[model samples]
Target chain A: MMETTTSLSFTEDGFEAFAAGREEPQWLSDLRNAAWKKFSELPWPARNDEEWIRTDIRQFKLDRYSLALEPLTSEATATALMRDGVELGGGCTSFDGRKVDSFLKDKWAEKGVVFGSFGDVIRSHGDLIQPYLLRRAVNPNYDKFAALHTAFMTGGTILYIPRGIVVDEPFHALSTLSNGSADFGHTLVILEDGAEATMLSETASEDVDGGGLHCGAIELVLNPGAHLRYVNLQNWGSNVWHFAHQKAVVDRDASLQWTIAAMGAKVAKVNQHVGLIGEGANCQVNGVMFTEGKQHLSYHTLQHHEAPNCRSDFLYKAGLQDKSRTVWRGMIKVDPIAQRTDGYQRNDNLLLSAAARADSIPGLEIEADDVRCTHGSTSGRVDDELIFYAQCRGYTRKEAIQMIVTGFFQKVFDRISIESVREALGLAIARRVREYE
Target chain B: MIDTLVIRDLHVSVEGKPILRGVTLTMNRGETHAMMGPNGSGKSTLGLAIMGHPNYEVTEGSIELNGEDLVEMSPDQRARAGMFLAFQRPIAIPGVKLADFLRHATTNVRRPDRKEGEELIPMRDFRKELKGNMEQLQMDVEFARRYVNDGFSGGEMKRAEILQLAMLQPKFAILDETDSGLDADAVRLASESIAEIGREKMGLLIITHHDKLLVHNPPEFTHVMLGGRLVETGGIELANELHSEGYDRIRKAYPEADAQNQAMLEKEDAQPVG
Candidate 1:
């Protein structure tokens, strides 16, 4: 058994020691200190807060989890889901917020593609990454969780694509957390003008039912005419408490296809935002969430049209079984100058059990006169007739319910361009379905 | 060994309303039967009850297939017992492809003892078989890729149902209004396809209003339902008589049953349209 490292708990001494031990650049250390100070000043989100009203975290004791000062090995590590049968340009794997393995193809590296752990890359290429690190996309002071993540963020993946370089193969990253530990991973991806890349990232636990805490951030900064397909699957253990702040900013003539699947977590609150910062920028986001047991997952998404003639489409589908619940709040905000913007947002929830619940709230705030913006939300139980129809065709009640639940999410899955991701998610959900009847 | 489905004075109700009062019928493999009835006469209810629909409560009597009581089984178990029902108004499964749905059904029915999550039939063989069935039904192969009955035209839905009937090839099959809402050419095609795929291969209980479907697969037995009971039983000639002439004569001859059928029809009309 690994010994507990409580000395790295949230404190001024701990923060200083953590930064000094990393031997990072002085500028990065100063940035962490500033974030640490901000984290100390910020207050915990109250129950009455708008975002926290539906997701209760009062029972979450932060002191129960501490940072691991030394590498902790485990017997059972979760196999990577997205990497199965996938040809990749590079891959990175981390355990308990410690980088253990990383590899990149020399062909891409020769063409000026940088892919590896964030800690090593940030230290070696600080001058190249300094402009976009915690600056453009994700706001570190948005909440206490975001501030803490910025302050203590450890092992993560970083991908830097030089100007006019487009790599066809995808890069995979996996983060695994052990019991009673914490993961404060930060992902940063920077693409220059006319460059393109695909990033597949996932998080899991050594034990399927283990307990831990994960406070993370992801920032995607796309320069002019850049294209990106970013897929992230959050499969933390059921006992984990997860909080993340992820954002992307698309520049002139750039496009982004972001697909996210959330299947695990005891209590999760995630903020996903996309900013159309330049003219002719476009984005399409597909979200699939399936929860069982007593998991509570809350997601808040924002499609901000900051420039004219931009388009954004967001669709989120969720399936809830057992006593689990999901809350999805989406907004399509069009700026006054963003005329000719075409924005659409939709959320559909399928309730597999009577005790399960879902809260779907969709909104739009458009100041552009010529923009066409629409949003719709639907929440309902699986129709008994659909189940009966399948049952009459020789499917057992359990298999019938499983097929129907899978069909419910097929619309969002169709939007995913990666075959391995789609297969992995489909199998993962099938394994979790029980006899809802 | 055993190839028979016998219904002994079966009584079924929807909610608290009685639909099938006392239906008794016996069918064997390699035989075709026609069940003719007017609207609200409980023809569909008998098929539903036979399939063990949860809403259709079988208060009394039993449905036996091959010496086994099916009333004690779930719908899926009944399906595995080689009994099939083609609904009048099939439900839509939005994101489920018809090919995938039929593949699973065929696998489960073929291997009744197979556990869940077990391997399905080989895809190459399944694909070739599904293609052949689709072609025989005069359907485009693209139809298999579409969602099951979602956004399908009335005619397309019926053809899809026939495709499933062809694929499953159950020992006993109930087709409810398999010819309704179809054009003459489509009806003729469906009739020919059903005769080719099912005639003399399985026991068929075809419930339809028109005789177009019967032209190709003539029933050996014809039963007329009124007041939730089979008031008349005859041969193929009886079907031709009912097709050429309406049920007015039969209704006039059976006054008590006529009165009950009128009462049920009136009650059905009183309910609101969806």
Candidate 2:
């Protein structure tokens, strides 16, 4: 077994060299330049910043890793990586800045849905990809990672659902990194009005034998009355550092639901922002994170109500066992004119061991006094009575606690409208809980 | 006769105020005992203390089941030791199916060898057993799939407890005001369940204030409790006497019993025990 060291760095030479070698669009090259400037100008998040108070990132050194321009094509390595995604019940496509693995095109392209490398989308469907790619749905000014992802993103997925088209099953795009590798994968989803689809973006590592870095971004746009369900299941094995920015813009009467399940990664930072931009727009954001074995998971969620009569609800639950730690900070902001806005935010956590810890910071900033706004945060252990009740029946203490925790997380699972995604999340959560126990 | 439950000089309290003081009772296998008392006479407290509820503290006493100490065990341990209590007010636990809970309790109390062998009840056998018990108690079959006592009416909750008693089949059972808050039909069904348990060689201790339950299943030993103490012990005829005269006669026959009762009353009024 090889020892891995996960690290990230900022260097203009590496960015420019990769861009020049790929012969990317000149406009994208300019965007990367602006992002690099922003990444350098912005200061590190401080303890006074309300969202970053409970999370300590002083130990995260970004100067230890260089950009990985090469792809791992070994048959054994690709075979091992594809096996991890097989359990998720979908065909997988793997990308390295140069070429895509054939498994994706041979199995996924026949469905009339585009599942390919970002470069392929630019080369084949430049007309369809021009207007919708990086259209500011995910602003690069939110945080340093957002800026970093925009500056160096190289490989990703481009999914375009034709009008009134429906995909009966899910297709997976798995982005992984090898030893001393750096990855920047971008996933762009555009669902025309009346289009229905389910897309899953899973990021993981082939193995944790050496240090690697994964910085990715996902942008989703749903037109009027379009329905889209996006699930990001990120379990980048240990000895990997991950940072991601995901944003979605929903139009009139359109519904977009985002479910994020985070299990691995030595240190993971995520920012998810959803904008309900039209009347009658509905958005639900549900996330479940399990942190164990000294893992650190930091999640920041924003429910921005920009349109009147729009509805948004966010529920984030985390379970911490072993000596792991997690921080969940969420804000529901109702703009001044966003009247009749219905929004709710709740963060509940279960600390299974004394050494494990969770911090929940839920807040509300409502400029409209007449709207309904509420936020709640709670962190505690499993209910003793519930546990005792289960134990008295025949289950051992471990089995009883596991069942209760699984049920505790079932509320989030209940919100999943897709049966396959719901089942996959349930099995994954159960497996993580058992591993921690 | 092998004693199934022996409670001697039991002094139980909640939050430093005594509820059951110097009360002694014993029930052997194949017998049933009825405890009749007025409100706040520590009847329910005695039942809860014997079952090892965490809220009720036994200040001084000993409860033994088949020569094994009961006070030293937890509520579940006591339950696993062949002792069961049908709560006057059952707590509702959501997301836990009634059938699942019953199967757990039954398998937990079974002998180790029986549990290890193929005799262990399968899911189908468990469902059939649950269905039979529900039918015997006149309960809806769908109730078995619902959460444990969640959103159940008062009558339905009591009947559910009896359903548990029928399925778990503990050696010694305590019915704490099981007949309270029930309609006539539900009362009759509950009493029938109690009588059926008594007929199965399972010792029973019934606590009640009215004679409605006694009308259906007559008790062998009738004890009248006043002020946390047993003032008199008689045959089933005592129930008839109390039914006719109300508890005032017991208060008149023992004047010091009344003052002692008053003291107990003031003690209870000062700090009420649940």
Candidate 3:
């Protein structure tokens, strides 16, 4: 089956056999081939690159990583500890790039809400999925990793809320990877005019020793008058190297509330961009990351206001302990047509140990004269006064520091409207904080 | 016998400059002592040093709690050993819910004898006791929802401090200038709460620069501090003496303390930040 190579590297014949064995559609094969061509042409991120300045990913040796290449082979275990779908709502669990379990409430299904496996949706709603697959959001050629993900994309999930349909239920998806395996998954969400829903997606590496790869992409589109709340929780284990490219486009009068929690992975680099493309559109993007013990995490975010009267806000907060380090680069861009646009972006970092380090770079690019745009970044140590107060209450220094760090992230956590996701993410953050202790 | 906190000839410093020097004092269980002086007389330093603030170095002397040396104990260790300090300026921790903070604190301090690293008090008991204490302090039940001192008024911060004292129920509490920023009503409430906590159950070290807060709950010992020295020890009448005469006579008598004040004013008159 040519499932592997001598050096655990990817080769042309192996990839062709891998794709053809899966019987992927011809167009998908062509798309993947083109993506691979682009990936081969581009260069690895350089030290002088503006976005790559604070983060150096030279240690990521892609050739050494191996893909499972087989879908649920014998003895394959679904290692993901699945979270329950909210009562009456529905969720799907994916094991090593294949859908495992999926369910949706009857009422929402009755309302024409399409929640299905990525492949199933592509075949069933082919017309609706074709045009916006990777064209409207998450451009494949944006970077080296984006093209790599597109070239090797295996499995994914899609949520489509039909026009005028208001889905009160949440649709969740979890992608799990086994040790010595790689998963290239994609997520796509489309809300037509006046459609509203929440999409919560999470990824984790199954507990095992050998290193793995969790590379993926996300595409979200909100039609005029549509409102969507999207959340992405990334908590791959210490041996996993995670990379993702996520982008969203909000139309006129539409709103997108996007929250991301990055708390795991040995090293992770992600690019998240949101575009307020229509007048009166609004978007709020938030991120929380807790890293410890030599973990290196980086996030590059862009909030683009392309139309007049659009509003955008982005806040990224991180807490680093032990020898962990984090880099956050957030940019807000206002177009010339975006008159009276309101844009704000901030990145805050708290260092829990002297060995921990954080770099926050907030930038604003305003091409419009009448726009109100601002950006700020701050990195500071924990306040001793706060710790002393907590100590006087009998809490150990660790607990006091944990309380302060939790408070720092709680501001972002509470904005996550989904109770289960909020709680699960909070627990994940707490667990990460306790990892050092 | 309950517990006692004895501070003997204590010397303290911040950033290599001395703040409190050769200050000796003691208060056994069921006793209230007020240490009063003008601003920058190191009254707060004494409270902080007793609480073992890391930066407030105890350069000399010993602080013993029930015969155990507190000078070497971490603040949390001292707290677990039944010490409390109501900061004149309580720090605001945004997003840390009041209920959660109170619960952890109540559990830790209340169960000092619990094995190290043991689970905290049950959430049920913690919530019930917190409700009762908040009610007693006239704190809004919603105070449980808000962050600790985050966006709270000056008076609310003061009340929150007392709330900790009442719930943690420490055997020794030092109120560092507890009456500085309170309104008349809040000051009255704070004094009443302190009085209710009482000297018999706990030793109280009230550090203040004014006698207004002392009126409601008079101290058994009123010690005047000048230039970080314990200059006088008398009844509450000494408070009245200073309240009327102000620090003029005392400042005149303690020329060295007055010289320290002059240097501070001159420093301020120069470039403050520089």
Candidate 4:
């Protein structure tokens, strides 16, 4: 069996123990084991590494955390815990590795769509899940976190849309971290050709008393001509440490848009990679992150064009206030074979206070002479002219600043194709802005 | 008697350079005041200062409205007190819907009791009102949905300023060089709109260099400004005199004194004010 490596020894051992006990297929076990060895041998990112230069990861003790196994006290208690520190809407399922609370599985399953926990998918649709299991679009050697997530991922959601299926509503899946316990979840999405859907996933901590850790992985595959929109809102408790690896592959003539809204976490790191492997593929990556109270968010993104005539656009905006900090490094790569490719990358930051800080680095690597690629990054305070204009229209200085920040983020919301999800995010962002006031 | 807008010995500066040196003007309810001057004659600076723009500082003198002090108030506060300024070059604000902005400004300036008596204008009513105003300005209905003043043509931008003035209904308005960029037909239409707005008890302070605006809608008092001072005050004929003889003649007349005092004497050939 093939096994993956992870940073934490206990997490690797626990997952290895699960595989051995279940007597899973040798190929799957070997994959996990190989992943575990890679996780142990890979050195932790240092300050000099270009990707991790602006983010410090020394404070995280990976070995001390292991996958959660104990059952929650009750379904009601688990539901309450998952609902805290985050917002969830229609057709939501909250799970704690043992029992599923408020599951709308049957209703969704009847519509020819599979919306359930990772364990359920493994039990019911093993054949459909086997081919994509542990198949990551993001390179495992990209960072230590990517290697770690491959070894210990246990539970998540698997969304499979059959051909020509279009779901008018958004389906939400939330994974809750038990108190004082570590969590490793996985999200697998396969949109068949001509399928259109939107999936929203939120990761939050169950315990408000102190910090915990959550490390998860997400993989998405879009067949030819499929459309998928994914939104991830990470509002872990202030004491939590979060590391996630998410990737998506768009096939010929397919399109995908991903929006990442990060608000809460003491220290967080995310690696998002998208590959347009087919001709005429399109993808847009938009994100807005707000950090305060000594929190730090580090984002690494890649837009890879491997086929001809593909387009990719990326915009990430961050707001740092009250001594908080953020780091964004994004790259657009065009291969020589990918002639006539169009790619753009932009990262803009707003510093609300003197103590807040942000670092943005946008780069482009083009191997095709016929391609058009441009990248830019800027970090600064709010525009005084915009603020003054708002004030002249009867808003106070504070009100004017808040309105500008809200308006700054509204651009991302405009790109969301789902109305209900957009509204939900709009309300959440408004509340966050008010909290600063 | 108290008037809608009263400026007394107004001294203003921009970037430490004096622009308005003790200029005085007043406009009562239902009255129109015309200010004529060549380029850089401090005509626009007076309008900006009177609107309490933060960039322009009043180093000396005072501005009042209906017996209340205006120099100490903020721009929005002055706006709420029934003052408006139609900018010569209106700024474009992107991502802000024009209709939403109009409603916000109107509701902000509305009296508290009156605001309570009426519901916030329904979207439909507001749209109809906006359509009417756009029709009056010869603008398409699509202009209302675009970002405020974003990508508007020269004439369209001026028409938008007037549309806002009509919707807001300020008691005193300072139209600074509103006719500078408009064509002859547009100037005639804008003049007619201003005259219609003036019939609603709104006092007008029209600033321009051309005599065409005054010919279309004559002013009750015409003031000539040169070197940051209101050097001459007379009836409407002063604008025609300056148009016929040109400002060089005024400069030659005041060669010994200051340029402002000389321009004042040149316009003094017309019917004099008390």
Best by DockQ: 1
The candidate scoring highest on TM-score is 1
lDDT of 2 by residue, B18-126 (tens): 7787888888877778888777777778877887766678899899988799898866677777777787777666556777767766776664223322345578988
Across B233-259, the per-residue lDDT of candidate 4 in tens digits comes to: 888888788889887765565553256
What CA root-mean-square deviation does each model show from the true structure? 2.0, 5.1, 3.6, 6.4
Clashes of 4: 20
Q: What residue pairs clash in candidate 2, if any at all?
A: A4-A210, A4-A211, A5-A211, A6-A211, A8-A62, A393-B104
The estimated TM-scores of all candidates read 0.96, 0.81, 0.90, 0.84
Better of 1 and 2 by DockQ: 1
- The iRMS of model 1 comes to 0.6
True contacts kept of each: 0.75, 0.13, 0.87, 0.17
Q: Encode model 1's per-residue lDDT on B187-261: one tens digit a residue.
A: 999999989989999999999888889999899999999888889999999999999898998898888877887
List TM-scores of chain B, every candidate.
0.96, 0.91, 0.92, 0.87
Candidate scoring better on TM-score of 1 and 3: 1
Error of 2 at A202 (Å): 3.9
- DockQ of prediction 2: 0.21
Sort all candidates by DockQ, best to worst.
1, 3, 2, 4
CAPRI class assigned to model 2: incorrect
C-alpha positional error of residue A241 in candidate 4 after TM-score superposition, expressed in Å: 3.7
What is the DockQ for all candidates, taken in turn?
A: 0.81, 0.21, 0.70, 0.20
Off by over 4 Å in 3: A1-9, A74-85, A104-111, A123-127, A208-210, A434-437, B16-18, B114-139, B183-185, B199-201, B245-274
Q: Quantify all predictions' global Cα lDDT against the true fold.
A: 0.90, 0.74, 0.81, 0.73
State the local distance difference test value for candidate 3. 0.81
